[model samples]
Target: MRYIFFFFFVLLTLSGCNKHEEPSSNLIVSSFKLPPKNESAASSDAKDEMAAPASPEIPQKIIKEASLRFETDNLEDTFNRIQSAVTLNKATIQNDSEGKDYNNIYRNLTIRVPSQNFDAFINAISKGVSYFERKDISSQNVTEQYIDLTSRLNTKRKLEERYLQILQKATKISEILEIEKQISTIREEIEAKQGQLKYLESRVSESTVTIEFYKTIAQKEGVKTSYGSKIWAAIQSGFYSLSEFLISIISVWPFIIVFCIFAYFIRKRFKRKKK
Candidate 1:
C-alpha cells in the first residue's frame, strides 16, 4: 500500500511539472520567434497595393501641322492680309521672312494656332490667296505614346516612394546607400517622363501652319526705244572688258618679266654660238 501511494504521487508531480513547462516553452517561442512566411508575404502584398496608384484617364492626343504655298499679285499686300488673318484667328507668327530676289518678291511665315481654330485659320489663309501651288496637311497621333509615358511615370513614382519608405526603415549603412541610389534613379526617370509628357501635351494643344507666297514684277509694254542708252551701255561694257584684261596682265607682271629676261639671255647665247 505504501509503494502504490508513492508511485501515484510521483506520477502526479511529473505531470504537473510537464504542464507548467509546456506553457513556458510556448511563451518563449511566441516572444522571440519571427512572423510566419505567409504573414510576411501578406504584408508585402499590402505594401505593393499601397505603392501602386491609379492614373488619370486622358482622351485622344493629336498633333496637327499644315503647309501652304501660293502665288499673289502683290507680295506686300498679301503679307499684310496674312498677318491680319493670323491676328483675327488668335494665332501667333512663330517665324516670318520677306525678301526680293531679282524681280520677284516672296514671303514665308510659320504660324501657331490653337487646335480648335486650325481649320478656320487655314480657310482664312486660302481665301486670301488666289491659287495654291502646294497645300499639305498632316496629323500625328500621340495618344498611345502619351498613355505609355503616363504609365511609366506613375510606376517610377511608386517605386521611388517605396524606396523612400525602405530607406527610412533601413538600419545598416550599406542598405541605406543602396536604397538612396535606387531612389535617385527613380526620381530622375520620373522627371524625364514628366518632361516628355509636357512636350507631348504642348504639341497636341497647338497646331502649326506654314505659308509661302510670292509675286513677280510685271514688264511694261509700249516703252519708248532708246538707241542712245544702248550705245552708252555698249561703250561701258567695252571699257569694263579692257579694264579686266589690264588687271589680268598686271597680276602676272612678275612672272612675265622673269620670262622676258630668260628669253633675252637664250637669244644672246644662240647668237654668240652662230657667230
Candidate 2:
C-alpha cells in the first residue's frame, strides 16, 4: 500500500509538470506567431522621412542706387569722358539731356549698370572729378519681399490647381462656374505677382546712377564790346525797327486803300456843293 501511494504521488507530480510545460511551450509558439510587418513598415517610414530633401536656401536680393552732381571745367569734354567710362564699364545710358542757361552749361545723365560693377563704374567716373555738389548712395534689401512673393505665387498656383481639380469633379453648373471664377481670379493675381517679381529682380540685378554735371561761365571773361561796335549795333537795331514798321503798314494795305477812296468821295461832294 505504501509503494502504491508513493507511485501515485510521483504520477501526480509528473502530471503537474506536464501541465505547466505545455502552456510555456504554447506561449513560446504564440510569441513567434506575432507579425514583424508592423516594425518593418515603421522602419521604412522612418527611412523615407530621413531621406527626404530639405528646402533650398534663398539668394540675397538688393537694389542699389546713386545720385551725383559735379562741377566740370568743360561740359562737352566731361560728357564725352563719361560716355567713354560707361562704355568701358558696360553700362547703359537710359536718359541724357544737355542744356545751356545764361551763364552755365549743364548735362543730366541717367545710367544703369550691373550691380557687381556699380562701385567700379562710380569710381571710374569719379577719377577726374575734383568735387561733387551732391552725392547720394542708397541700398534696399528686397530678399524678404522676394521670398514672400515667391511663396505667395506658389500658394496661388496650388490653389488654382485645386480649383481645376474641383472643376473637373463638379457636376452642377453653379459649382463649375464658381470654380472657374476662382481660378480666373487666382490667375490674375499670379500674373500680377509675377510681374512685380520680375521688376524687383531687374532692380536687384542692375544699379541706377544718376548724374548731373555742369560748367559755369565767368562774367568777367565775357566778350568786351568796343565803342565803334556799339554804334554799329545801334544803327542795325534802328534799321531793323524801321523795317518792322514798314512791314506792319504793308500788312494793312487793303484797309488803307478803302479809307483813301472814302476820303476822295467826300472831297468831291464838298467841291460839287461849293460850285
Cα lDDT tens digits for candidate 1, 18-70: 99999999998888855336534644555566457774667889899999998
lDDT of each: 0.83, 0.87
lDDT of 2 by residue, 190-238 (tens): 9999999999999999999999999898775555545667889999999
In candidate 1, which residue ranges exceed 4 Å CA deviation? 1-57, 100-103, 218-232, 239-275
lDDT at 182, model 2: 78
Count of residue pairs whose backbone atoms collide, per candidate: 0, 0
TM-score of 2: 0.67
Candidate 2: Cα lDDT at 221: 59
State residue 212's C-alpha deviation in candidate 1, in Å.
Answer: 1.1
